[model samples]
Every structure is written in structure tokens, then in C-alpha cells.
Target: MAKRRRRYQNRHGNRNKTKYIVIGIVGLVIMITTLALTLLVKNQKITLKAPWTLEKSTRIKTPEETLRTYFSYIETKEYDKMYELINEESKQSVTSEDFIARNQKIYEGIEASNVQIQITQVDDSSELGAAISYDMTLQTAAGEISFPNQAVLTTTKEGNYQYLIAWEDALIFPNLTKTDRVKVSISQPERGAILDRNGNLLAGKGVASSVGIVPGKLNEDPTQDLNQLAELLKVSVESIEKKLSAKWVKDDSFVPIKTISKLTELEQTTRYTSDETLEKRARNDALLSIPGVMISDTQVRSYPLGKAASHLTGYIQQVTAEDLEKHPNEGYLETSVIGRSGMEALYEKELKGINGCEISIVNEEGKTKLVLASLATQDGKDIQLTIDASLQQALYESFAEDKSSSVAMNPYTGEVLALVSTPSFDSNDFVFGMSQELWDSLNEDERMPLYNRFRQKLVPGSSFKPIIAAVGLETGDINPEEDYGNAGLSWQKDASWGNYKVTTLHETSPANLENAIINSDNIYFAKTALKIGSEKLQSELDQLGFNTDIPFEIGLSKSQYANEGDISTEILLADSGYGQGQILVNPVHLAALYSGFANDGNVIKPYLLYQKQVQPQIWLANAFQMENANLIKSAMEQVVSSEHGTGHAAYREDIVLAGKTGTAEIKASKEDKSGTELGWFGIFTSDKEVDKPILLMNMVEDVKERGGSGYVVRKDKEILDQYFGTQQ
Candidate 1:
């Protein structure tokens, strides 16, 4: 029985062991599960990432290829597989076709064998967005070119970087050779012919037979060589030498020589060159051969009209070092042609074409071995202007005797028909390099031909009366028949000119807006302007294009707005009444202001270009029809057609002409009483039943003899009457 009990106890122990094993297994499983949970939770917490961080940085191998491909697609000139990858934002600015054409030259110049690019830096901007910098090396058969450039780009969702945009060289590049060299020639356009409104050539490129030398080709001293060259050209040796050394930096072995100068007249400089062969040959041997120079063909600038449109057309001048630095991408060289002013400066891109190059081989001995391929230089486009040459000549002839200015505009289109400023100088002076004496003489002249008097400042005087009168009628301050007694005296209280009595130029009493305008009665208009007050009158004038500068293509003068708030009422009334006290004007201002009467009441934006259209029944039929323009025209008609109108001298029944005259005072001194007067006339004419009118503004300045008189502007009536004829 004891044995049985022991056996039973052993069995019990075994059962207990089995129970512990089960518990151990269960605990181990629970611990392992807990650890795994902890590890998973920790990993999740550590790996949290931002949304933007999902993107990957990318690099393009061939950046120029990317740009060319993209530009082609952007320009819409080619259907390429790469175009599908364009950025969304860039599509808005230009069409694919235009984009291709714009970059046509740039792409054509690139060759796969010559391309080498070095990735510089990746940059981010807060405003301008992302961009990448690059250093490029272009190795062509002729030579190797290196440039630093940048491309603006954006990263895509797919993590690829592409070319967004690029730019060309901004600073002027140094010549390939290290020597003093020059190639002087004239510039001509082959695309379109430039002509005046009268069909006369204003500017066009003409060929001049020329010869130039590479500095290395010269055998003798540059100075002595230049001296010999100057003697051949019949110009001062100093001038020729100065031009040769103008922008040159001295270098070893290579000195440029220009043996044959530009043709003064295209009529066969061959005679000039041929006649002086022995002399030129001696100079060439003495000056050029020492340096191992080479001959080259060059371009130049020409002004066919010479002095006719000098100020208007402007002229070309040598590019300064500073200019080259500023416009590095301009591809300007020492011998490059630049438009200094006028239309040349205005449309420089159109007037300047891409420069091409040649790929020729040079032997180890520094000799050109074989003829190589070449990319010809492009000619600039022609420019046409609105100037009527005949009319401009006539106006110039008339105003040549004195300091005067005239402007004529097409009423319907606002195209300037003719603009003339007297005492003009030859534009050729700048091109040929004016002598110090001639330049000094022009500068010393009191008339100041360089000043565009048409744009000069002046007080409108009585010409302000017509504008004020129109404002009075428009704003209901005065009626057409409203009577105003001038009393031939002061109109504003405390006015500086109060003590001085005004005289009535015409026989009239207590006149209305009609009579006051006709006689140019200072008192009547002063009272009218005062009655209207500064705010009301200013508002009206501002609407009439008086306070603001009108939009026009050419450079314009700013119209002076009186500081009515700061000045006294008496001053305002006196100055504002006669158009003298606070306001300022120029020829352009008068012409535009007078247009209000010519166009009825509508104030249209003045323009010079005519938008050409097709099909007469469509847009062409309503091209120039303006509605509100008539309101201003009706008022101007009364200023000339009415019996008491101020511009009766301009009245022409056949043409339906109307205008106003003004004479402003120019104070001489504080105590001394000698001063000048300015004369002005603004006219608008209708030749027949028309959609628009013809406008003219004529001004004569510094008329000292007619001091403080109202008749100065009126004196032009005889000329106007003769030129325009009696319409009535």
C-alpha cells in the first residue's frame, strides 16, 4: 500500500510539472508578443515624414539639349516627343510657334560635338522659384567659347529636373585675338525699305567699299601707320589714330590697320582708293605689314536725309565700355554699331540682327589653310515712320527763320503727320564726328536747336480761355449766352496784376463765352474760371487731357498741373484764367487739348500706329467711329464758326476749321521790366464729311518785342489764312 501511495505521489508531481510547463509556455508567448508590439510602435513613431519631403532631387545630363527641345515645343515649331513634358506655368506667356522662331538662331548655332556643360549649383528663391546654375563650354572647329549661365527650373512629381528658361551672354565678350584691332563699316537693312509718309527714303543701308586690317598683319608702329592712313582719307591724322585706339588694349604681335576708309559718297570710292594706290601702298607697308595683319569686310551706319530729320531720326555712336558691360548679352563688340537715340534706340532688337561666324582652319604657322564654312551676318529690319516729308519740309521752311515748333496729327488715327522744331542741325554731324568748332557753335547759339521746343514748357495764356470756357459750358457753370462784363479791368481780388487795367482787343461790351473767347478778354475768362473754382475746373481740365500726359509713341512733354491748393485764390484765378498763373503746357498738350473740340466730347487715346484690317464691311467699317468725341467737337465749332469766336482767323467754311490762340508772359526780372511772350495756336480742321479731324499745334517762343500783349499769338493768323485758305 505504501509503494502504491509513492507511485501516486510521483504521478501527482509529474502532473504538477506539466502544469508549470503550460504556464511557462503561455507567459513566453505573451512576452514575445509584447516585445514585438513595442518594436513596431517605436518604428512607426521614428519614421514619421513631411509631405514635401517625398520629392527626390534630380539632375539633367544635357541641359542645352533640354532647353532646345523644350523651346522647340514651346515655340510650337516642331512636334517633338519632349514637348509632352513641358511645365504648366510657362505655356501662358508665348505660343509654341513664336517660341521656336524666337530661339531659332540660338538652336541652329549649337552642335553636338561642340557642347560641354558643367553643373554649378542648385538654388531656391522665395519669389523667383527654383533654378540651376551651369558653366558651359562650346568647342567649335574655329575656336572654343566658354560662358557661365543659369537655367530656371522646377522639380516635378516624378522627381525629374528640366530646363525652364535661359539667357545669353550679358556682358560684352573680348575678341578671340589679343591685339589692337578695328573693323569700321556702315549698317544697312535688307528686310524692308524705310520711307517717309511722302514716300521719301528717310533711312536705308547703303554699301560702301572698305578695307580693314587685323592688328597682327601690320608690320610697323601703329601710331605711324595710323598717321599714314589719316593722310590718305584727307582727315586729321589725330582723328583717325584716336578712333583706331579708341577702345583698344595693347597686345603683342597683332595690331589692326584700316588702309581704305569708308566711302564719303557711294559714287565710286574705287577712284579714291585707286587714285591713291601708291600712297596707300606705302602707308600699308609702313603701318600694317609689321604686325601680320589681315583684311576684313565691315558694316557701317548711314543717314540719307542728313540734316532733314536729324533730331527726329537721331544717330549712331560708338558703344562705350560701360554700355558693353551693362548689355553683355547684347553680343556687342568693339566694332559693333549701336543706336544712340530716336527710333534706333526705340527698336534696337528689330534693327540689330544676330552675328554669325565662320569655321576655318589655321596652320601651325598661323596661316589660314583652307576655305571653311561660314554663317553670314544678319541684316536688321527696316523702319517706317508717319512723318509726311513734304509737309515736314514746308513746316520747317516756314519756322526756320525763328525759334518755333509745329505738330500735325491725323484726327481720326492720331498719327503724327508732321513735327518740326526750328533751328535744326544736321544729324550727319554726329555720324561724321562734328568738329569741336561746329559743335561749340551749335551749343553756344541762344536758340538752342538741340532742345525740342515742341516739348518745351510754357504757360498757355489766353489759349487756356477756350478750355475754361468749354469746361464752364460742360459743367453748367455758364451758359453759351450768359453775359459777363469784363469792365476792361481786374477780375480776381488781390491779384498781382490787379492794379494794371486790361484793354479789350476787340470792340465789344459785356460779352458772353462767345464774345469773351473771340476777343480773348482776360477779365471775362478770369471771372469765369474763378466762378468755377479750382476743384471743379481742375476736374474738367483733367478730363480734357490737360493734367495728365497723353499716351503717344514719341517722347512727350509733361503738362504742368497748377498747385491750386497751396496758392491763394487771387493767384489761382489770375493764373488759371489766362492760362498763365499756375498751368504749364507744350505743343503736344495744346494739340491734344484742342482735339476735344475737333472730336466733339469724346476723349480718345492718341495713337500713332494704324491697325490694319481686312474686309471693308467687318471691323474696317467701324474702325475709327467714336461716339462721345462729338461732344467736344460741337464746343470747338462755336470757338471758330461763331461770330464772336476767339479763333475767327482760323475760320474756314470750306474746311470747317476751328482754333484758339494764346500769348503767355515771360517775366524778365524782379525789378527791371523787360520780359518775353510766348505765342500759340491750336487748330482742328475737317476737309469734308469725315470720320475724324486734322489737328495742328503751332508755337513760337521768346517773342520779346510783344511784351504783356494778347496779340502775339494772333499775329500767326496771316500765315494760317494763307496756308489754309478761307473755307467760308
Candidate 2:
């Protein structure tokens, strides 16, 4: 009975212990549930997955987005951000300094600040990476450089998210490796050609040998190479040094010393071997033997007509620093040649085409690994001028040893057939480089060879009598048939002013408009001018395009007419009537003035560009009444056909030429009583059978020894005969 009771007590005690344990477990469960509820209310994220799965929850950057960011950093030059974005493997391979150095090499001679990068497209087809195509542009001294480019982006895992960009040299430029670099090569476009109306070549590109030195390839000191090249080429060593010392010339640049157009001429100047000997010796071998000296083919401006068209064609020269600064956005390169004057300058933009380039990947040895992209260069347009090459050549030769200027044009169309200013320079000399001695000679020449005499102003002398007659007839001051008694060889405002006599070359007792023009009667014209008064005479001159700028492609000096103030004095008015006062006119203006008479008082503007058909600008419509213009034309005809005509020497039986002659006295000073005279002759044909009536004006400066107006008239006859085929 005692053993049964003990077993029952032990059983009860075990049951109580088990119940206490169960209550503790229930309390712990309640606490855990309350904490979970608080966490849920706060919206805290709690992953119930593995650490690897947590990575999936974090944001992973897209390959395109990563590449866009990379490009932005590159464009902004944020090297820190760029470095951070680079893959760990790439960073380990290259240091920050190395990366910067590599970029510097890519734009060694360029202004990196002006570089622009734009991502044009992005393709993310691969699971691990993306391909980004872009365009890179750089503003250089040579011009704008634009090319298409491509890059690659890859993904990588970070702490909790996957980052993109497996950076490498190849990522900066597609197909470029860590060991490879990029090289840029520029190809210049062909400049336009200049042609004459006859389709004859005036100025064009010609192949020539350019002698230069590559400093990096030099086998000895630069001084030694310069000396050797100078001796071989028969040029001063200083010149070679000056060329190589240019600011833009780099160690790898090929510095040009000179260009040789005619090998025979070079041989003659150097007293060297002939072409046969040069060939036997091998031109390349001889040039290569001189340290850094090299010979390469280059384009040179060739003026086939030499000095015949120098003034019209002008010349081109290397662009200066001032040129670049003035035109920052014009894309002018330091190595470019620009037109300095004449038509070349007037049409520079049309003649200079777009320059192209090739962006390539190269090795350390300077070998091209791949051509990433290329742009084809565009050639410039060809320009054709209105000048008749044959007529121009003939007229230029006619000037011979004379220092003169002349203009021959079609009166009806205002097309300039010939515009010649004698003693012109050799344009070829300027193309290569004019020597200091030659330049000095031209500037010092007493004849003023450098002056464009055709565009310069000169006194019209008695040739202005026709304008005075027109003024008188138009103002009704005098009739074409009304006679103003010829006042002997001299006249004055009155007998009281006897010492201030106005002299004439003729002594006709009764001089009408025809008689005055035929004799070039200064006295007769002077009296007519007084009758018309200074106001009316000045108005007539204004209508004749005086004291106004002539609109032409090539610039012209304004022709001047005497102001009312200038003709205030009676003696001054008399002098001005015969173009002896402050009256000045250029050859072009004189031609246009006469052209009006031939076109029935409608003056046409002269032009030299044939491609652009410029409408005729009437300087003065109805400058003179039809009757007055006819009267002037008839009197001018008498000046050549009549027995007493001063320009009788210009009369052609077959051509029926009409003209005037003048002898203008040039005073040494305002107080001088007398000075040298300039002879002048202006002639035109009245034949309707001629396709284009030609008006020619010829002048001889300081004709003290060359005779007077008669001499100029005879010369005109010769020129006219040659031009019109009316030679006897």
C-alpha cells in the first residue's frame, strides 16, 4: 500500500512541471506577435529570403543609362566621376594619371575645351552589355572636326545592386585596345578654277614639288639639316630656319621651305645638274640624303597668262593670325591660303570648299590599325569672268613699255572687253613668295607699277567739253547751231582780268557746239559754261555720275565733280568748264559716261562676272534730252571726221570712228603757273553692223616728251584698228 501511494505523488508532480513549461511557451509567442504587428504598421521591409535573393530587390542600373552617364561625365570632363564609373579591372590596369595622359595624346594639338560629345543611339541586345553609337565634334584651328563613334558598356555586381560599365580603352573608341591610339588625318579640298569668257584658263591648280623638312625624322640637328637643304636648293639657310620656326610647326610637321614649279628653272638658278642628271641620281634619293629634307607633290596656283591678268586675278597667301581672330567661326586653318585682293577675295567663299577628314585608330609605330570613319572632301565651283582673254592680251601688249591704264567696253551691254593696267606684277611671284628686293623695287618704281591706274582718278582735261556742251544745250543756254564768237587763243571773265587768261588750242572766230568739240576749244566751252552758270553746270555733272561711288565687283574710287564752292570764282568756273579745275574721273567712270551717249542717254553699269547676269543699273536715265544727246554724239563724230578735229588721227574710213582728245595741264602746286600735261584720247565706233560697239579711252601721263593729245589719238587709232579688224 505505501509503494502505490509514492508512485501516484511522483506522477502528479511531473504533470504540474509540464503545465508550467507550456505557459512560458505561450507568453513568448504573444510577445513575438506584438513586435511583428508594430513592424508591419511602420512599413519596414523585411526580406524572408536568402542574401542572394536580396540582391534582386535592389535597383540595378540599365546598360544604356550607365553609358549615358559615362558620356555626360566625359563631355563635362569630370574625371572623378568617369574614374568611378570605370570597371574595377580597368582601374587596376590603368592609373588615373595614365588615363589622363592617354586622353591628352588623343587631342594633342587640339583645344579639348571646345570638344562636344553626343550619344546618337544605344542598342542593348546582349544580356551582359550594350553598344552606344555617338558623334564627337571638335573645333580646331584648321576647322570643325566631326565624326561618328561607338562605345561598349558592361554590367557588374556591387554590394546590393548590379552596376554597369566594363570600362576599357576599347569602350572609349570601338575596336581600340589599351595598346592602340587614335590618329586624325585631314584632306584639303581642291580650290576652284578661274576662267575667262572664252573658257580659257586664267588661274588654276598645277602640280609642283614642295621642298620641306620633317623635324622628327631628321638624322641630325635641325641647324645642320637646314644648312644642307639651303645649300642644295641655293637658298639662304635663314629662310629655311624661319619656315621651320613657325608657331604652329610641330616636331612632326613637314615645314615647307619652298615650292619648285619648273625644275629647269631651279636647276638654272642653282647651277645644278639638268633633269636627266636629276633622274639618274634619283630626286628622292638626293633629297632624302639631306637629313630631314623631303620632296612632295603639292598644288600651286598657276597663272598661265603670267602678268597679263595679275591685277584682275589677284593673288592668294597664307592666312595670318589676324585673319583667324577676326573670323573665329569661319573655320579657317592656319595652313589655309586666302585671297588677298581682286576677284579672288570677292569670291573667296565660293572658291573654298568643305574640307574632309579621316578618324582612325593607329598603333605606337604610327601604322593605321583601322579607319573608324571618313568624310569626302567637296571641290569648289569654277568661276567664269566676262573678260575676253584674247582682247585683254592684245590690249596689254599694245601698252608695251608705256606706264598707262585703259578700258575698252561694249557700250550697249556694258560688258568690259578689255581692262588693262600696264606694268603689272607677276602673280606667280606672289603665289610662291615675293622677294623683298622685288617688292621694294615695285614700291619704289616711279611708274607706280603696283597702282591700279584704271581705278584711280585723273583730270578729264578737254575731254570734258562734251559734258559742258550737253549742259548748255539742255539748259537752253545755247542752241546747237547758236554761235559764240571764238575769242582767239585766250579769253578772260572780262578785259579787266587780262592776266588770268584761259587759253585754247584753236582760234576759231565763231565756234558753235560742233566747232568747239572739233577744235577742243577751251575758250568756247569756257564762255558756254559761264552762260549756263555754276549751278546749272554742276547739276549736269552730277547727273553724269560724278562725286559718287561706282558699284562694281572690284572696288572703284569715287569720281569727283567740282562743288558749287569750287566754282564760286569766275576764273575757277572757266577752268572747270574744260575740266581744268578740281574735276577727276577714273577710266571705268569715263567709259560708263560715254556708254550713256551710245545707248541714247541710258548709262549701263559695267560688270566683269559672266556667271552672274547682273541687270544693268542706269546711273542716269535720260541724263540728256534725246536731241541734246544726238547733238553731242554728232559733234563727237565731227571731232574725228572733220578736218579741224583734234582727234582726226583716230578716224577710220571703214569703222566710222568718233572720238575726242584732251591735254590736261597738271600743276605742281596750287600756286604753280604751269606744269606737265597728260594726253588723253577717247574713241568709239558708230557702226550698227558691229555686234557690240566698242568705247576705248587711252591716256598718257606726263606727256612732256610723248607729244600731246595727237600722240594719244594716234595710239588709239592703232588699238582700235587691232580690236575692230579695221587695220589698213
Candidate 3:
């Protein structure tokens, strides 16, 4: 015990207890002070690097808050609300409706698939702004997906950091990120003005003041506003109510409900009530607020002559659900002026320009609190067409007599001077949507006004006679002066009794190609077809741009030619020689083929668009000249110049017009004259001064029993009258 006590006292006594204690206390205090100072400095400054080296020390957003704001939109189907929260700048560039519509399709297969988000890295004190990295595990209906997203948020003058517009995250989802929006305004393009070559306005988008509506801005009764709107706009109350209800449901804020369009002073003054004027105390308060019902500036599409260029220009319609399915990103609201047909459909891309948008913030009730993004709407581009409105009007009037069609083209350039489809409907019917009554009438008419008959199928008849004669002479089947006995019928059929017979219009027999075409002698041409054989004849015609379809801006029916495999007899040859049996051609195809005659045996492909200036030619290459094309031109010229010509009545010595006429029977029942025949006329000028021949072909279908000939004669005359005037 004494030894133990001595050891303990020695150990305690030997050490300087106060000094050791002071040293240990000082070491502990120094370590704590170092840690405290390190933590204080670390928490106070955050270093971050940006694209532009923007640097700042600021409080960072928590991962939870970011995820809540980002994913909350997916949980609730409030896509419009979600759009509002996007960086204001981006919101202005994108259409809210378009975004919602696009997301709706993507989200249809995704539900409550939790998105796991984690911040990986952050850079501070850099000119590029705050760099944030996120790791996300997204769950979709297809499978679980994971990806990393990053962005740099730039600091504004308010010290609040906003998203960078050109970043990877912005590319993937521009509407969701805070740093991806644009803040610039847009200027709408001026409304396009349409003018003819002579500077006459036929169709144009004109500037006219309009009334707009903001559905969220109303304080009065909905019915009162509706009634007031109806009285002001001179429309039914039901229509205003419907429009208002739609605006409310769609939640449109910027676009106003138009109460009137292109209003007169008298019409504008009638909007006020008598009670407001009589009561002096309430005069200032007479104009009650209405949601979406207000006057504003707007552009309107107008056709100066109303229906003058309806078919060629076509019309516009609001994009439907089908359009949305085809273009999910374009959205419904912005795609209002879709081209319905004609030139409008062909040039849609050039016409519709960039769209403008705005980003706005709304409260829980869907009230807009702030505009987060903004840009003005841009206007569409303008197009100048080759159609001549005045000539179009004149042609329209000429074809008004009967169901007929006419097409005029410059043989050299292939520019269409006139393209008229007869028994036509007023284009105004399609504008603003057609009425059920007019739509039914258009569809029910026997004339088939909607059909572009110039491109429709028809037997060429005697118009093909010149073509057959040319084949015979080229193939050495017949000499120019070869004698062919009429016998009142072809070699395939006997005409002993002269009952079922073909006859020459002239009493004497034709001695050459000129005489043959002049009288349109069926017997001579029919015999020529037999001698050359249908195979060789068809080959020559096909090579000269016959029986084959020609390509254009619109679809066309192919011309029909008898295949060698399809025919085996002289009887078929005889019928085809007279443009019957199985031969059919459109006026445009035949008119183009006739270019060979004027072009000195070289048939040029028919075209609607100019080639050298445009990247691609609108017409197909079906043009070629056979070794003996002159044989055809020589004969056709006589049909108009010769005294005994079938087209003698149409001949003009002054202009030297060469042409061929045809009449094809349209049979219904074996005994019915109730069927009509199509009459055709193809013509061109013979003057040397005319560098290129002008070609015109007109066709009139369904003239029967008026005469034994089964052709519409007056309609053919009307077409010739116009052709002569225009050609001159």
C-alpha cells in the first residue's frame, strides 16, 4: 500500500500539472477556432463558372424545390399552367396551345412515373453564370429512362438568375427550363397584296381594323355581354355566346372577341343605348366591360372581285383534328389559315411564315399574373402567280354558255395563258366554309363543275386524224398522194349498201395529206391506220407525246393508246384512225402534242412553270419528234386553210390559224341518243413573226340529239371566238 501511494504521488509530483493542463487546453481551443473560421468562410462564398465566365456568390435553389416545380406539372394535367412557369423568354417564342397539344400526345403513354432528380455539380463566380448539373431517372410507360441535364442560369439586374437561351437543356425541353426563354419582341409581316400583271387587285390580304376580346377581362353578366355584342356586331346572340364560351374554355387572353369587322360610323354609333344617354349620371359608366369584346387592329383576306380567281387561288380553312395528328408540334390555335386547294396548297410552305408567341404567368384559378415570355406574331410571305385574272374572267364568261373547257399556252415557254374548266362553281362558296345547301348542289349537278374537264378523259375523234396520217407517211405505209377509196366505210367493213357507213364531207376523193385533213375524210385515214398497223401507229403517237400522262402541279389522267398486245385486227385500226375504239386524250395533252407542228417536228413537253429560273420544272419530259413529224403538221394546216376543210367555218386568212376539230360519241344505252358527244378544237397561229405558236384546245361534253351529228357545235364556236381574240 505504501509503495502504491509513493508511486502515484511521484507520478503526480514529477509532472508540471498546470503547464500540461494549459498546453492541452490551448491545443483544443486552436483546433476548434480553425474549424469555425473555415466553415464561416466556406458558407459565405460559392464559386461557379458559366459559358461567359459570369461569377457570383448567391444562395442556391434546393433540389427539392426544383423538382417540385418541374414535376408538379406532370402530376396534374395543367399543361397550360406548366407552360406559364417556363422561363418567360422561351414562353414568348413558343405557342402555349402547340406545346400543350404536343405534350398531350407524349404524356398519353406516361403517368406518375416518378422522376428522380439530383444535383451533381454547381459552378459559381464565373461570367457564364451559375452552372447546374442534374441527374434524373424518368419513368415512362415504355420503360424507365435516365439521363443527365445541365444548364447555366444568368443573373439579371434584379439579382435573380434566369436560364441561358442556347443550352443543351433548352434544346430538349425549351418550355420546362427557366434559363431557355427568349425576351425579344417580333414584328408581324405586312399583309400581302395580290395584283394582276396589269396591277389590278384580284385577291389580297387587306388591312382592316377588327374587334378583339380578352375572355378574362369581363365584369358584367355573360348574357348581357353576349346581347350587347350581338347588337353591336349585327349578328345573332347565339353566335356571340358560342364564341365567348369557346374562348373561356380555351382560356385565350391575348386574342380579343371581335364584336364587329370593317364597321361604318353609323354602325359604331348604334352600339350605345338610349338609357345611358338619357341618364346624365350614368353617361360615363354606360360602356360596360365585356370579356373578349373590343375593337383592335387585324388583317383580313379579301377577294376584290369576290369569285374571280376562286379556283386558281383556292381558299383557307382552320386546321382540324386531322391536321393536329399530322403535325403534333404546330398546335391548333396557330394553324388557322391552312390552304384548302389549288395554288394555295402547292405553295403552303412559302406562304406560312414564322409564328410569334408570349409567355404569361397565371394564378391557381388560371388568371394571368405575369408575362414570362413575349414576341410579336410574324406574317406570312407573298406569292405572284402566272394566272391572268382578266383573261380568266373573259374565259369564264365564254364557258358559261355550255359545259366546256379551254386551255391556252405559249408553245415556247409553256406558260398557261388561260385554264378554264367549265360549268364551274363560284369559288366564294368554299371561302368561310361552304353552306350545306350549296355543297349539295355542287356535288349533285350533272355538269360536274368540280371536275377539271381539260384534264378529264375524252376520245380525241377526228382530232387524231392528222396524227394517224403522219404515221402512215413516216413509216412508208402510204405516199402523200396515195389514193384511198372511201367506199363509204373502212377496209374492215363493207359499204355496199351504204347503210352503216363512213363518208367524206367533200364529194371528191382527197388526193394528198392536205386534201385528206381539209375534208376530215374518215375513209382515207381509216385505210391509212390499216396499212401502217395499230402497233406502229401507236408507237409513233406515243413518241410524239400522246397516250402517256404528263406531270404537272396536280394529278392528271393518262392518255390511252391501243397496245399491240391489246389489238389484233384491221377493224380496231379503222376505229382508232377516226379517234374511236380505245383512244382517249385530255385537251392539255393534245394541245401540248400539237406544239410539234408549230415547233417544226419537235414536240416540247407541256409545262405550267418556267424552267430556267425555277430549281425544278413542273412538267414531265414526254416530248420527242418522230422522223416524219412534218407529215402531221402539213396535213393539220390544210384543215384550216383549205376551202373544203371540215374546220372551214373556223378558218381566218388574216391570222393563218391552223386547227383540227373532233366529235366523240358518249353512249349510254345501245338505243339512247340520250348520251352526248365531246367536241374538241386544237389550234395554233401560222405567222412567222410569232416566235412560238399559241395553242388552244377546248372541249364540250354532252351535246346530244340537238343534231344528228351528236356534237355540241355552239360551244365549240364560243371557244373559237375567244381563241381568235386572244391569239390576235
lDDT (0 to 1) per candidate = 0.56, 0.74, 0.58
Over the stretch 1-728, how does candidate 3's per-residue lDDT look in tens digits? 99999999988876878778889999999999977864553333221111111246542233222223444455456667546435556656677786676555445433324545555665646664566566555544324545566655544333223433222324233233433232222334433444554556655664444554566665556677766765554456766556666634554554444422244344446656456333522311232344555555565666654444555566666677787677654422443666676656666665665456544333445555555434466566666654556666766776666677777776555666667777776544454345466778889998777766766767888887767766676678988776565454233356442333444445436446667777776777777787888778877766665655575565567777664445466666677887876787877777776766666555555554333353323232433344456556666677667766566565654566777877776776435556777777777775546643467777776655443122333444454566455432
For residues 50-127, write the lDDT of model 2, one tens digit per residue: 111223466545554454455455435556555666777778888888877776566543433355555566677777
Between prediction 1 and prediction 3, which has the larger TM-score?
3
Model 1: per-residue Cα lDDT over 1-728, one tens digit each: 99999999999999999999999999999999977864453223111111111134544423333443333332232433233334556555545664444334333332213344455555554344456555555543224556565666544443354444433212111222222111222233232334576557665554333444454445566667655555544457665455456466353323333324333433233444655554545644543353434434344455665555666666777778988898874546666667776666766777676555554334445555433334556777666676766666666776676677888776545567677787888665565556667788899999887777766666777777766766776667776676765465443354565554343456447577656766677777777777787777776666555555656667676666575443355555546777876688767766765555545443334544333431111111211123323433554566677766666655655667666777777675323467777777777674425434467777777765653232333444444544454322
Q: What is candidate 3's TM-score against the reference? A: 0.62
- Could you estimate the TM-score for every candidate? 0.60, 0.72, 0.62
| Model 1 Cα shift for residue 53 (angstroms) | 24
Q: Candidate 1's error at 455, in angstroms?
A: 2.7
